[model samples]
Target: MHNLTSDLALALEVADAADAVSLAGFNARSFTVERKADKSEVTEIDRATETA
Candidate 1:
């Protein structure tokens, strides 16, 4: 049970970090889009969010 609490807390912290990255990049003036290897459109924001 103690470990569960710690795990949940860690997950929440990670989510917060990811959100910060996404929001920071959300309105980037020079943001661009490109096709991924699978032919899907992706943006700098998406990569930043994932990298967070």
Candidate 2:
């Protein structure tokens, strides 16, 4: 149980880091969602968000 709590905390920290990067990029750019021929939204922000 103690180990489980520690692992959960670590996971939360990683999530926080990812969110910080994503938010920073999102704020730095004007992200526009464009629909493809298949009707899917795509943007450079999406790649940045995932890579971050």
* Top-lDDT structure, candidate number: 1
Error of 1 at 32 (Å): 0.7
lDDT of 2 at 41: 88
lDDT of 2 by residue, 1-52 (tens): 2689889998888788778877876888877777878998877766665665
Error of 2 at 20 (Å): 0.4
lDDT of 2 at 8: 91
Per-residue lDDT of candidate 1, residues 1-52 (tens digit): 2689889999999899999988777755578899999999999888888878
Off by over 4 Å in 2: 30-52
- What lDDT score belongs to each candidate, Candidate 1 first? 0.86, 0.76
Candidate 2, residue 4: how far the Cα is off, in Å: 1.0
